[model samples]
Target: MTKFIVKDIVDKFGYDVLAGKDGINRAVKIYGINRPGLELAGFDFEKNNINRRVILLSNKEQLFVNTLSEKVKKERYEYILNENIPMIILTEKFTDKILLEIAEKHSCPVVRASNITTSRLYQLVLEFFDEHFAPATEEHASLINVFGKGILLRGKSGIGKSEMTLELIKKNHLFVGDDRIIIKQRNNRLYGQSHEMLKNLIEVRGLGILDLSKIYGLQVLLDETKIDLVIELIHLDDEQYKSIDRLGIEYKYIKILDTKVPIITVPVTYGRNVSELVETAVSKLKLDEAGISCLKILQERFEEYSK
Candidate 1:
């Protein structure tokens, strides 16, 4: 339900507004961009529900339209204008005076970007829409990338989340964010990043704040990553530990911005190497992704032995 104005795109991309300045406030309801190729070739816009999409006129599409007869071109323009599209973008220095006139007549905004190619323009607009329309939330935790997998560490303050992340950093894992992690859901996946002011800064008890990138080198940090796992560290008494499941066969998931990320609960007990345990957990997740589940295999063997 997110809406953006044609003026927003014009301001953000610095596009030249060729005509339809009065329609700058036109609402763009959908994040999709259309080429208008099929529509130019007699496709029905109403049937396809393309009236809400922002139209882009690339070089090839423009050239193809130029080959059509004048009557067909006029009809195409009339059909498009009547549909009341959000806006039209001409990519890579290609411009049609006739199309601009039609847009002006119907008060449809037409913009031109001459610097980038059509594909690059498409990519930029896609990224803009993805970031603008994505569902996002924030978490008070630390995120790190280990072996190309993003792992989020969450727990109460003083539960050693930062300290454990420090250990992972020493083991050559990459740090993403500390204290506050911004998580956004795009295409059913969760991605995490640090706040602008807190990036690369980690706080340790009694040690003050430390710049992790400075100490461990720039290669030991990632600006953002797709969150693949969530680990929660809990300080449990002996009785509490005894009441928990020992088999570790249950699946736990934490919801972040409409995406469910697998979560593991680890007891923060003395003499336990939480960092190593997390590392091993990530490796096990990789194995699970590859369809090699150690827990399932052990359960199968146990079933056979019991029989």
Candidate 2:
């Protein structure tokens, strides 16, 4: 992955360059917004990961800097800048003259984010870095939203994933992607979307390619969704289906970009309403969440009758 740098943040946020033009390209390793409360009180910079974060001297830090001895301020400033951190951001209401002098001397970029409070700026900058460093991948699947649950349909070619998607949309579910899905994992959760070219479009055997937005209206389309469950379709005969676990008491999770997503295998047979099965499966999941499982209830009833 390309390193996110100080200049990138400067250009992106339109912040003023108060000092340190030379080191504006310094790389950022983490998304932490460091206020340096500990370092201000004479804590050692060498002992912590200051270089990994973009130092922000907010209004509080700036006011606190005035009370510090000139020796303490100068020594701490030099120590922090020497780490070669990405940048130092000053919020709207704050600036430290001594810190800027040391920062300029060491070539550590000092940016001024105007018109935003320290708390708001911290939240904004954290989100920016978190999103920038998010892990992403591509998967071959048809993603849809059924009963407000994001469902990913996967199988071999000609296994009716697209056909099932069509039927699901007709039943008022939302379509996300067909064939190629761009899966991004952020903050330990996976979000899936279609490529711009493939958005709201699906190819059927007899219908070639169809724009779902045109046929079913734009209300039936979604650009992306959080992947809640994956339903894998398999062409299983009755004998093969009977051998597998009939009760879904335990769910198996498949790792997608460092996130484990629950996966369930469904047998697809000729003349079966695969889309209805998919919807019913999601409904069962909802019931399971509500502490009502038909299979578990059946087991209890059978045990009671035997007793």
Best by TM-score: 2
Q: lDDT of candidate 2?
A: 0.84
User: Model 2: what TM-score?
Assistant: 0.76
Q: Tens-digit lDDT track for model 2 on 1-307? A: 5677888889889999988999987888775777788877768545565456777888788778888899988887766677547788987777667878988888888888988877888888887886667788888899999998999999888889999999999899999999999888877999899977788889898889999888989999998799999998888853546756777777778999889998888999888999989999899878977988798889999999999
RMSD of each: 5.1, 4.0
User: On residues 220-287, what C-alpha lDDT tens digit does candidate 1 reach at each position?
Assistant: 88999999999888888634456556666765787887778898888898889999999898988899
Question: Which residue pairs clash within candidate 1?
Answer: none
In angstroms, give how far residue 54 of model 2 lies from its true place. 1.8
lDDT of each: 0.86, 0.84
